[model samples]
Target: MALVKIIGCGNPLAGDDGVGLKVIEELKRWGLPPGVRLISAGLPGLTILDLMRGADQVIIVDAVEAGQKPGTVIHCKETDLARVTFRSLSLHNIGIAEALSLGRLVEPEAFPRRLDIVGVQIAEITWGKADLSPLVAAALPLAVHTVYNILKGGGPYA
Candidate 1:
């Protein structure tokens, strides 16, 4: 049975903000561990409830313009995320962080044991399509490694 689900959410046309999707594509090449499911979402919040209806763990990869240095990676848990004081250029209407918290409230039992966001800080968010910045692009491997380590319960930060 699938025990974990990794959802990459972003808009590919929005410059470095699309890092999540890019990572998803790159992840395909590495393949995934057994019991782990990978999916790409274009800001579908509630809709994901079904896809992750009974997952034991969930990891969300998204681009966040949190005013930090570009390419900086911020890993935060679900509860900690609720304390965030600022917003980014999210593709969803209610915001992914709020959606996940509300999702957990609606189905506590079905909620993942671990819910983390692998956020990559972006320097620019443009309207038109463009490749990811070198900095953000360089972060994909580290982001993937971070997620893997988080899944294994032994990340450097963990």
Candidate 2:
């Protein structure tokens, strides 16, 4: 099993919502350690379950609507995920909370030992707005660093 798996979820065509995938791209530039897998889960809201299998730890990075400023990065646990919803990656996909509930019922044993969410607060997720807003773009480094810290030595949030 992979020691840590990082799944970056988002729609690149949807402006700031793309920060998740962008962070994966940045991580790609740096050499990743063995047993650490990075997945660009673009719009894979429900399918995330499959990507999560076989990892000891799973870190999901995505856009979140938490009534906060656009660039804020929030590290969320299971309880926190229940209160915050990821910016809709698709019209048909269910929320992260529902997805986790399903996972618990259908395949709880397959879940990772540790699950964390690194969410970037977004103002909006317009389908055709291909560019991230200035604030969100500026926050990309911070988000990436957060993921790196967790992967390297269990970040403060951990």
- Give the TM-score of each candidate: 0.88, 0.87
lDDT of 2 by residue, 8-36 (tens): 88888988878888889888997688888
Query: What's the CA error at residue 46 for candidate 1, in Å?
Result: 2.9
Best by lDDT: 2
lDDT of 1: 0.76
lDDT of 2 at 146: 87
What lDDT tens digits, residue by residue, belong to model 1 across residues 1-158?
64888888778888887888887888888888898888898667577666667778888888886777788877877776645532445566767767776777888887777777788888787778668888888888988888878777753331
* Residue 63 alpha-carbon offset, candidate 1, angstroms: 0.5
Error of 1 at 70 (Å): 0.5
| Position 130, candidate 1: lDDT | 65
For model 1, give the RMSD to the true fold. 2.2
* Candidate 1: pairs in clash: none
RMSD of each: 2.2, 2.4
